[model samples]
Target: MSFLRSLSPLRAWRDLRRFLALRKPHEIGFMVISFAVTGTILFALYKDAAIPPTYKRDVLYVESWPLSRTDREIIDQQKADLIAEKKRAAELRARQLKRQAEFKRLDDRLERLGI
Candidate 1:
């Protein structure tokens, strides 16, 4: 019986009214803004958690070529891959050499300063 009385809608509304009545308008505005921000964040999190993804997965790194490619095509692809790999290696090597040169120059400067 006591639990049922506590659950009454009229009492709940009265309590809510009393609580709101005690709050300043600016406090209520801040509370409303806080609730809006919190609700927006929760909604965004819920959307991000959805199954089957609302957007495509990050840059799918699968082969775009057909499975029944010709042998010559495969050889060409291998050649292209080797060329690209060599190009990247050459670029990285150049960068490394430049960095080493800079460090050597700094070392020589420090040696001249006798530090």
Candidate 2:
């Protein structure tokens, strides 16, 4: 136990000297900078990967409207009916304009006849 005690003090002193010798000023500075840079990069990556809890919302159940085959057929028929109605309206307007021009020509003829 006495021998062990003597060896431990010497070993501790040797270890201390070795540690002090290995830590040069430039090496210590480089280690400090490297650790700071690694810590910063890891922190940035962790923050980027983390999801914010404030944005989480509650889920809601939604009911959908059911469409049968007959309903789809009716919708298609209505679309066709609307297109036909639009075409009929356009034709009616064109005929009305033609009749108005004919009426204007008749009025001009009556004016020339002084009636």
Question: Top TM-score: which candidate number?
Answer: 1
Query: What Cα-based lDDT does every candidate model obtain?
Result: 0.90, 0.84
Q: After superposition, how far is residue 54 of candidate 1 from its true place, in Å?
A: 33
1-115: candidate 1 lDDT, tens digit per residue: 8877679788889999999999999999999999999999999999988757333354647788998899999999999999988997898789889989999999999999998
Candidate 1: segments with Cα more than 4 A from true spot: 1-60
Clash pairs for candidate 2: none
Alpha-carbon lDDT of model 2: 0.84
In Å, residue 79's CA in model 2 sits off its true spot by: 1.0
Q: Candidate 2 on 1-115: residue-level lDDT in tens?
A: 7886677777899998899688989988897799999999999999988967533374766745456558777789789979988997898789889989999999999999999
* lDDT score, candidate 1, position 36: 100
Regions of candidate 2 where Cα sits further than 4 Å from its true position: 1-69
Query: Which prediction has the highest lDDT against the true structure?
Result: 1
